[model samples]
Target: MSKVYYTPWRNDLEMVDKFNKILRKSNFLDNIEKDDRIAIKLHIGEYKNFAHVHPLYIKGLVSALLEKDCEPFLTDTTTYYCGHRFSAVGMLKNAFYHGFSFANIGAPFIVADGLGDDKGFSVKVRSPLNELFVPNLFREVDKMIVFSHCKGHGLTGFGGSIKNVAMGCVTKKSKLDMHKVVKFCYNDALCDGCDACKDVCDREIPLMENGKRNLSLEKREDCMHCPACMEACSRGAIKLEELEKIAQVLPLAVEGIYKVLGKENVRSINWGANIVEYCDCMPFPGRTIGKNTGIYLSDDIVAADKAFLDDVNKSTFMIDGRPDPEIQTIEGEKIGIGKMDYERVIL
Candidate 1:
């Protein structure tokens, strides 16, 4: 059974009606309980990125949840890199700047991983990697209404509900480990005695001498793997190794999500309209990839992602990698997370 439910983008006036029809048709709303502490998991968009799940849509969803007596709260995890969303204060400011205020979205925004990047509770899970996650606030909640703006990612090829939960709901420490696939290698031959890597090294992993420089993995152990050094290099000598390890993190990435929400207690809704090439992590907005494809709702996270991928594939527009792309959510499915084959219900 295809799990994708879709509604075309009509006039803005019909947005709430269209969403309700889609939600009702999908039957996902049936799962909510009265007065349920529903965690409305979402990305509040970066500083300048306007291409996120619209606040209007969120307010509609919030209204729907309120009707069910579900106490919905907007939620997301902070970033690993020191940025706008690295701390509760920063995330709140970014949320406010992006129009995620209680007045606008009708829900209080909460940073799930606590005030700092290190705050979270660990949960054990069964995986080849034995991925453990610091279960965030969503874990304490009774139910979750997962929302995502489907888009492409530099690493995952695409980002959807699974990506939303995996990366958006976990602590920055986990993100550092997951994204640290590539290691920077110093090119002694290209070294110009600039010691550029040493200067910008947030983890202080690189050391500089009178005329040469050396990098230590022991010191770089705290590296968040954000690739800042790759851009700062003046000689363009720093090389990345173990590139293959980067892709491996995708599957392991969702383990934390699975650990927190589990399969039974979560439902997903994704806004595929205005699909973009890059993720919402960008502080600045980018170009849209395809036509408005409406929204989808499902209890199966992998199924929702696969269904969204299929919609992207069916489109005539090219998004670098869309048509016949490998099922990126297979890693989640392999771990008994969710199904991929779905029943598409077009509304």
Candidate 2:
């Protein structure tokens, strides 16, 4: 079994010290070599969500990396939806807005996909998506530290280290491809003509016709696959299909791990603090679902995510009345990435 190091979050000790101790206990820094350009892959949170992994913890990681004479840079990819982080310029602004400035974290911040979301290289994987477009800069890094915030998600059940690597490292086109399985349709019988879907849709794909909403194939083609429309429908007029297919996307993340840093050269960390019901991509804050479960670190992405989901499942929180987050780990194990079973080592 793989080893997963964990440290409970305590109010007494400084967070920086707690984070550094976890890193050291996990031997995350020991894997780095002198002068290695380490990519600290992370989601810097959306415009207004404060639930993202605190920048202070990242500062601690950067300090630890620097002590080994290694170079570390904080990076994330642009989003497919129209939001603060949809473009490189907007993403940097949003990062700074969320207090991820170089002055704050002691490391440079870069949008892995370039200015216009056009910079990327492709990698082939054995999945419905035979190939994925990874960020060009992410491919060039010698090593990577996947720093993710554990939280609930509408589509994938939960987001953690595995979700971070699969979606966060890839370009927008690849992200859309993975999300293609999430197709939506309108239930005219349940429609109350609220136009709630139109109000929340970023693509303005939902159209009102004959006192009900209709989404054309051409309009749905531009859908970002976000759950805004599904969630906004009070009467349950909108229906979604193929949610289980989200598990198929895990191979992209598994392939990304091998293509980018290789399994041995990467360390995965999940911040279980401020566990929210929705992903950080939301423009608004979400309700806290699970209580703080602390942090988890492991070289095995599958094990780390499985352990994290196990903790989340222990809580009363449920996404769509079900704990659907384990699919990624189950699918990951089937793809020969890592094991679902692990030995937990608390520090």
Which candidate achieves the best lDDT against the true structure?
A: 2
The lDDT values for all models are 0.71, 0.81
Clash count (model 2, backbone only): 0
Tell me the tens digit of each residue's lDDT in model 2 across 1-347: 99888877675256568888777766756778999999999988888887888888888889888888988999988998788888899999988999899999899998888984674787887668888888778667998899999988777778888888888888888888888876666778999778888998888888888888876877667887778888999997776667767655865566665776687877799888888888888875578887788788898888888888777653444456424677788888888778899998988
| Clashing residue pairs found in predicted model 1 | 1-342, 1-343, 2-342, 2-343, 3-342, 3-343, 35-69, 121-135
Q: What's the CA RMSD for each of the models? A: 3.8, 1.7
What TM-score does prediction 1 earn?
0.83
Report the number of the highest-TM-score candidate.
2
Cα lDDT, model 1, residue 27? 71
lDDT of 1 by residue, 1-347 (tens): 53667776676668767896666566778888898898998998877887888888888888888888778999888887766777889889988988899999888998887886555766654443355556457657888878998876544456778778777776776677667655656678887767667667656766776677766657667766655565467786776555445444555656656656666788888888667766788655456667666788888887887777776653433233222223447666776777787887778
lDDT of 2 at 271: 87
**Regions of model 2 farther than 4 Å from truth:** 314-317, 321-323
